[model samples]
Target chain A: MPSRQRLWPIHVILAVGAAAMVAPFLWQLITSLQTTGETTSVPPHFLPSWQWSNYSQVFHDTKFAQQFLNSVSQTVIRVLAQVLFCSMAAYAFARLRFPGRNALFMLMLAVLMVPSQVYLLPQYQLVQNMGLLNTLAGVVLPGLFSAFGTFMLRQFFMSLPNEVEEAARLDGAGTFRIFWSVMLPLAKPGLISMGVLTVLWSWNDLLWPLVVVNDDSKMPLTVGLSTLQGEHLTEYPLLMAGSLLASLPMILVFLAAQRRITEGIALTGTK
Target chain B: MFRKALVLAGVGALALAATGCSSSKSASSGQADSGPVTLTYGIWDAKQKPAMQEIADAFHTAHPNITIDIQLTPNADYWTKLQTAAASGTAPDVFWMNTPRVGLYAGQHQLLSLSDKPGFDNSPFPKALNDSYTLDGKQYGMPKDFDTVGLWFNKKLFDAAGVKYPTAGWTWQDVISAAQKLNDPSKGVWGIASPDWTQENLFNTMLQAGGQAITPDHKKSGFDDPKSLAGLQYALDFITKYHVSPTAQQMTDTQPDQLFASGKVAMFADGDYDMPEYKAAAGLDADVAPLPAGPDGKKATVINGLANVIYAKTKHPQAAWEFVQYLGSKEANEIQAKTGTVIPAYNGLSATWVASTPQYHLQSFIDQLDVAVPYPVSKNTAAWTTPMQTTLDQIWGGKVDLTTGAKQIAAQMNAELAKE
Candidate 1:
């Protein structure tokens, strides 16, 4: 009886937290359907007539499909590259025995302490020197490697026992074989977590993409959405509708991966 | 060894895929494809795309050997993006420039000087408009258009209240009396929808009262001057003492423009750019008049203009300059005027612009240009405004008195100006 009573408060707290987190998205969805006059009405309208054509209008007004494709391509390539490269680097730092391995690991971790802006100007110059301005490669190259992912995976790998890898090595498996066949599958939680993070960051990145890409046709959804905001200043309904559409992909990703993400977070806590 | 080979193959495939995706098909506007030539024109407003395309078509007709690509970036992101492009030496060949940002770009030498460019003439532009874009006796941009602030009133509201419509030479006292007479609180209407604390909006009023926002040398604060303080107090009195304007909180909840559009306010003081929007949204007839004069009996309006600038590092300088010249010409101005997008800076184009939009009286904008003072600005305008606006907010919110706020802003402005 006492346990049941304690559980009720926990359930209530969770319900409230979920509602609070979801309210803004719901508001965005509702506001997107409103007319401009309805949006500015005094006391504010909570419900609005569904203007489904706004979804079609967003595509008609701007190069939404092209930008969406750009964002998807950039984000997918960036996330996949980060997962593979970071996992390998983390494997080397966690399991490999080599000269100055600890020092190299420390140097990699040191990069995470510096802010991102310090690298912006130099990185921009580097891209410019390479003649990659206004190109998708420039947007993806800077994010292809992530020190945070390396550090995260290294910590996760360090927490795992060596018995599983040793067994594979004892069976005549080489270092690469052990890492690829034995260890990576075991590091699924960490990889999943990092993959989600990489996807989220790359999908919503604005500043770096803004610097690299000049052509509107090459712009990602974030930059494209902002342009829509400025061009359609008085058309709040359309802006809101565009914003709602832009956020849908990220929301759907989170929803689909929520279970794995929660499990990863719980594992992270224990680690 | 096989696993390692597999990983290497994967990396190679990824690199190949990335390379394939990075390739962009370049679009050219001219017939010539032999030489190293690509002219990029940067514009801030997408609404002006049709006009820009027309200009580009005209330029292409004249010089078929040069390609011009119109690049549109919105206003808020334009400067930051341009700065990034400037730092990387890949900025568009030619771009739209604004007065507030001209000094910084010119001081940095990021803009191409246009004073000696062929087919360039400065005499057609008014002296007041031309002076804003000139830096150190060298011109970086041709004055493409001009704008001035004015009080836009709803004629239907005035007629309903039996109040006389404001004319060209109305005083601040006249405005206050008319506002008081027209005000009916119970009907959810106010006399004026005063802008919430913009130096651009308030400075003209202070200047009309024989005060300035900054010292003559642009090194000190003029906000602390008695006349400037009186102007601020008068703006505050509309909400506090007179109760003829919405409270600070109400203004915050809904912007003054939204309030005015909803017919809650009888008058709104803003630029001519809002004329089309007001006519479209506010279902009542509207008219414009010069900003009311203060006790000194001299009316002042803030004058600002936009320019087309060529980037310093453009690969096709000649072609870029041609496009810039075309955008600044009377032909492009006529297109803009007919669209009613803004009052074209060309001297005689106001007639066409005013005629294009009949719902609102746009002649007041042209008249105010005669007495309009340039917006007080410097290379470090943003730095000074940050602190000035914060202190002004406190005064408007009634948290501090006007004198104290003005003093604080003046001290802050001087410190910032010294840095500049």
Candidate 2:
């Protein structure tokens, strides 16, 4: 609402900040369209020569299509599973009165303190014992349940008015009915936020997928894109091109769900 | 970031080692009775995959019942994945092994000994390369390829400076003077790129100055030795005293190899593994010369090589051994040489590698074999090497003096080596 003349400094600062945020992405786009040599050339090549073949080279060298499909399926399964399972666990912890419930919730909360890497080997062995190595289920199973998600959703459920659940109960609804038809719909924002997080994490996870899956065809986009990297000499152009394509879907998803994510963050006070 | 992952993975490896997962139950034993055997050959370099595939195809042609499957894991995650798989007892049947890891794997009894295998001979490869894979007088790997350090200079930069090209017997003084002449700060061109690289820069100079990285017995740290400090000083002086090379910070921001490839660095000490990158670089006028001699009037280059090793628990040991033997054969070396992927470890085939790319005088790498020393290591090399690198980084950053940093490194390295 301030005058345009008086707001110039703030506008300039925001513009500068926005440019700083965008510079790396712009550089990536430029590099993606350059030749391998030009990417490493000194006096750095600012303008790209539009070497679009770098993108096609990614498909030729790796099972990009299969991996993309793998990533999509794995992410979809992980988000759905985490939402369903975490919400169920969260709902019980939030409203239900059970024996030693506080102690049980505390035990679940303790898991959030430990680093995930400490669990990598044991989880791997479990998956291996179950004969799930190199399978999509192996990658998705460990990620399906997260302590952070349960805790976040639990807080959201607690913040909701107890009157709504009581009204559902008065209508002859039980705990399961109240959770399914009433509490879940009320906690939509928390679920949406948790779902977004799981999608991002599952899409970008490298170490677990790299460990569980050895076959390139079964690898997700993250692991498949890594094969384009060489030990001593990586073709930066190809890597950049492939990375751009790999990130495009996430960017599109973010755009499509932009309003919902911000609204979810506003309602749940979580990001 | 990769180094951080390596340290984490190293901890994971230690945990694995502590567990002592010695159950070598052949996971693939059931497949032994099957008709065709597909042995997985794990490798890290994507650039050499084609040549490896060619060798595998040729081996398959020879042995109709054996098929070799090449598994390419990029180097960054290779060791981590290998250790995880090893713990789970699903490691590849055969895989590429490097000098740093040979001792660790062999000591852990994870690698199969090739010494008593029929038709397995180390005579064709250099003794230094062969010795790298040997522990307790037992051969565990077949030498596949070797890479020696060379002084790669930008020809156009040398011409612009009106300096003569480096040759076979150039001394350290000659290198200093040439670097000084070629250094042009205004043009953003450095006389050299002297980053704290152990294999390419520091190790070569350390050896040239009559210093050993580790004792022959691999029981103590040699960084405390005065001769080794002298060699490191020679490389360190380039940045601190002469200012001919880029600052360590600059090199970190932009890798020294990238600097050299872009023609910003006049001279770079690197290995043949970098040749493909340089060859592919557009408008890069570069060629190699033997690294300069040290103050002791003797030349030395740290020679490192990769070897093909089979997993101890491989179900199809016979087929794996046959494939490994073929991989080490003259014919397979020729295919590798023709592709110019690496200097084939087999003696007398280096000429083919030198001739593979006629543009550069790669023979300089070959000629240095006479004075090449094996890359140094202990049972757990990374335990000491990682600390050595940290101290060197501080020294290069001008945060610590050479004497203090060297002594600190020596103390730490000795402590780690003693544990090993």
Candidate 3:
């Protein structure tokens, strides 16, 4: 091990890096408690005036509790659906000897290349036709499957040893049983990382919800927070308060899953 | 094998479902007038949403069977959502429309014509506003509100500098002399905040200089014209030659509006739309005056307005029209004026808006109406405006000379106009 004196430079560098990462959140916290006048002052106000009413003002203006529930439920559904569907499809591509498997995999990979905006209109129309606009089902349906999730898991599944699967088959286990009882347990890290990605994406989704959901009651937190913004003028203090309040749950979640997230990311080999 | 079959069946089922959706959509557009109607009204401003809701409630009182649902999308996503919704034939029954997009939406037949409707009168609004939504001799939008550029000054800053407040008929020379006096570098204060903005700054200057941004026919660019170049130079000289205004980089760091509100900028050219914010800002003593005249003693301001327009494929056209008509009525305009959210486009309502915020001379924006130029726009204004702004940024940054930049912009703008 290196001596403490020898490692001082690395520690200093890391401290600076950590501070840089944390500065924006600290600024956001300060701004959330400031008045509109204080927020826009030149040279900026490092110390807040502590106008806590800004948080109350956000709640008064928007349906905060309802949007919080909407965001949570939608994020949960999207994460589960992506994990369940992507894992199964990933397994099939990794293990099954299906016809035109290469072509199918290539086609799925092509989806990852195209931007999500390209699918927005067609997806919106499809949901509209299904009479699912402004409903939880409409928001979750498009997010249920993702090519990136499938591809990421497929790579993980392929890297697993074939001997373990052969051993399971020798005991007369079917493909479904082997995938559920044997392979799934081994692919836990891949599934966790994919689910984490899905959670982040669904939680932050603004455009699709803004398009599909017209009612304030049906909006997710992201869309509801956006309503606080105006065409020409926006109350930054109120917006920051709402954003800070909205991000609390996610921050707690990240703290709880910090170790698992890092471990999963490392095991999966790609973010 | 079973999973593969399930996937194939799923794909086939989705295709069949899509075809089924298309068939149902055709029947939706021809909805009956007898049923209870709910017209979705789309708007982007959160500050104005409450006033809009009040207007909607008043409409609902008159037409008990018709309900108005207001949809609020932030301005950033409003156009994107509108474009997508329009493409799918599921746009809002009525929505707010601006001058730049009126041409495209009307030309594409995505908007319903309000002129042909019975009892529809265009005389209640200014001609410049009416002409903004009229294309090819047909009116598609009912003017809701209008905004014009004005010289907003900080009274305290003017007094501190011993400069008299700018009044009506003040010329450009007066502005330059006052700015030179007011500028205080030690206090980190600029005489003015001059940003490279079109509606609020450049277009008004261009018109005041007896120059047009585009030809009357809207088939060519006027940016390369000598008069237009002079106008461009006039705005540029504030930063480079006069050095009384904040640099482009400084304005970017702290937006011009914020700088003005914080007393760091003595004067700013902005639209009346920003009055509500200025009223709410604490410790800022501000007032408005008409913009100074150009070299030849011509006073001009660029005027733009928002309109209430009905989507062409609305399920209940009659109900939508009734709501739209109510929105354009004197009562609705009064409500708008009382809220001070906007200067109502309805004739003679400027006094009502001015009284709503009595501290400032809101009438300055209204007084320029006589000389106000219609906001110059083409079928696809963004095609040229977007590029023109990019080059103007370079010019404002002192990377390009005004004459060369103006000619470059004119050439690009002409090409876009030709395409249109």
Candidate 4:
């Protein structure tokens, strides 16, 4: 009976947490369906006629599809680049013995402590000098390398058993060969987890894209949604519809990788 | 090792290819050898884009050698981007600037002086409008249009409630009495939209009450003065004491404009810029009247205008200045006025503007301009709004008494003024 009581408390806590997380999304869904008149009613109606045409209107009114494509391409490129570069750098710092590697790794980690806003102006200037302003490269290049990714992967790599690598080294394999053939395949969960995070961050980013891309045609989903919002200020249903579309891609990515992410977390804990 | 190197090389090659594709794409869009010089014109309002394009087309007919490119940044992001572009020396050749921001940009030497530009005949624009763009006796921008705040009321609501529509001669007490009689809470109808934090609308109210929003030299806050305090007290009492307007929390939840547009409120205070939106949303005819007089029997309103200026860093200053001058011409202002986008600053174009919107008494806006006071502003205006808004919020929220809130706002505004 005491065990049952303890289980009841756990269920109650989880139920509350789940409700808290879901309440906002449900509100957004309901708000997205409300007409302009119903949206600002004095009592604030919670449910109104489902204006499903709002989704169609958002697509028809703005360059929503093109912006969605831009966001997808930028996010895919950033995720792949971060995963490859961070893992390679993490392997070097964790396992390889090279001159000045420790100091260099520390310097890289120190960059993580500096706020990203501090580098905004200089980074923008650098992109301008390189003639990459108003281009997707400007958005993708600055975020390709992340110190947080390196540190996380480095710790994961370090916590791995040394016997497998030694055995691979004895089998006529060099540093790159072992890292690529034996270690990389085993680090799939970490890479997938990092890729999901990179995609999520890149997809929702606003300020940098707004600064770099001046043309509406070149803007990503986030900036495009903002412009759409400004143009259709009186149309709340359409704005909410566009917001729902923008969030769909990230939601799909999260669900698809949820299993791998949980497994990666469990593995890290065991280490 | 070779395989790893190949992968790294592949990634690097992909990045380089992507960069090349983007650069080549932009290059192909605008042919480099085209003899007609391409000039970029920046504006803040997308709603005004059609009128600007019309002006651009007309300018192109006269100066066939020049091509104008329209670039729009919204109002909130315009100044920040303009400052950055100015710092980088890549600002558009011609850009829309406002009175509040022109002083700072001009002081920094970032705007091309238009005082000597040909075709800039100031005789066509009102003196008050032209003076807004002039600083230290030198003009940096040319007046394009002017606007003022007024009471926009729903004629249908007034007819339904059996309340007579507000006239230009009404006083503040008249507005309150009518609001109290017309309010029907059970029917989701309110009498007014008492804006909580905006100083532009409230400044006119204060001035009508024989008060000032700031000192003459723009050094101190006038909110602590009895007249200013009384003005704010009257505004706050509409929501707190009389319950004619929505509470602060209700206004914060959804903007007052939304309430008015949805017909939940009978009246709202907004500028001419919102005229198109209200007409489109409300279905019924919405009319404008001069702001009511205060207890001091004075009627005041706030007047402001937008201007067209040339960037100092432009590669083609002469061509850009020509475009800017043309935008301020009667021809361009007529197009803007006809479109109901703004009230043209050109003296005779206001009648055409009034004719474009026949649903409302749009001429009342121009009539009120004679008594309109310019928005109280200084070089450090941005520094003053933050704290001033916060203290005013307390007054609107009924957390602090009107006198205390006024005193606190004055102290904060004075500190900000000292920093300048």
Tens digit per residue, CA lDDT, model 1, B1-420: 111122232232222233232222112322234564668888766666777777787777777777678777766556656665676567788887776667766766667778867667887777777777877788888787887888888787899899999988799899888889778898888999765445336887788888888774566778889998877777778888888999888888887766776677898787776664566552546788878988879888878788888776666666677777777788878878887777777888899998987766788888877777776767656667666766777888889887888899888888878877
Which stretches of candidate 4 lie above 4 Å from their native place? A1-38, A45-60, A98-103, A231-234, A261-271, B1-34, B186-188, B215-220, B280-286
Query: Candidate 3 or 4, higher TM-score?
Result: 3
What lDDT tens digits, residue by residue, belong to model 3 across residues A38-156? Answer: 88777688999999999999999999999999999999998998999999999999999989999999999999889877678789899999999889999889989989888888988
For residues B1-420, write the lDDT of model 3, one tens digit per residue: 111122232232233234332222222443458968899999988999999999999999998999999999987777777777877788899999988778767766778788877888899999999998998888999999999999999999999999999999798889888899999999988988888888888888888898989887888999988988878778888899999999999887778888898889998999998886787777899999999999999999988989999888788887888888898899999999998888999999889999988999999999999999899888766667767888988999889888899999999999988987
Model 4 pairs whose backbones collide: none
Best by DockQ: 2
TM match of model 2 to true structure: 0.96
Pairs that clash in candidate 2: none
lDDT (Cα, tens digit) per residue for candidate 4, span B1-420: 111122232232222233331111111211233467889888766567778889899999998999988776654455545554565566788888776567666756677777866556777877767776777777888888888888888887889888999998899988998888779999988999897645335787788888888875667878888998778878888898899999999988877877887787887877777776676562545788878988978888777788888877677777777777788787888888888878998888899999998888888788887787766766556556656766677878888877888888888788877976
**Best-fitting candidate, scored by TM-score:** 2
Each model's lDDT comes to 0.76, 0.88, 0.86, 0.76
CAPRI class assigned to model 4: incorrect
TM-score for chain A, candidates 1 onward in order: 0.91, 0.94, 0.97, 0.91
Candidate 3 collision pairs: none
Docking level of model 3: acceptable
DockQ by candidate, in order: 0.21, 0.66, 0.48, 0.17
Worst 10 residues of 1 chain A by lDDT: A226-235
| Over 4 Å off, model 3 | A267-270, B1-32
Q: Residue-wise lDDT of candidate 2 within A1-271, one digit each (tens)?
A: 8899999999999999999988988999999999888888877999999998988998998899999999999999999999999999999999899999999999998898888767777788899999999899998999899888898898889999999988988899988889999999999988988888778888999999998988889999999889888877798888888888999988887888887677666755755
Better model by lDDT, 2 or 4?
A: 2
What does the lDDT come to for candidate 4?
Answer: 0.76
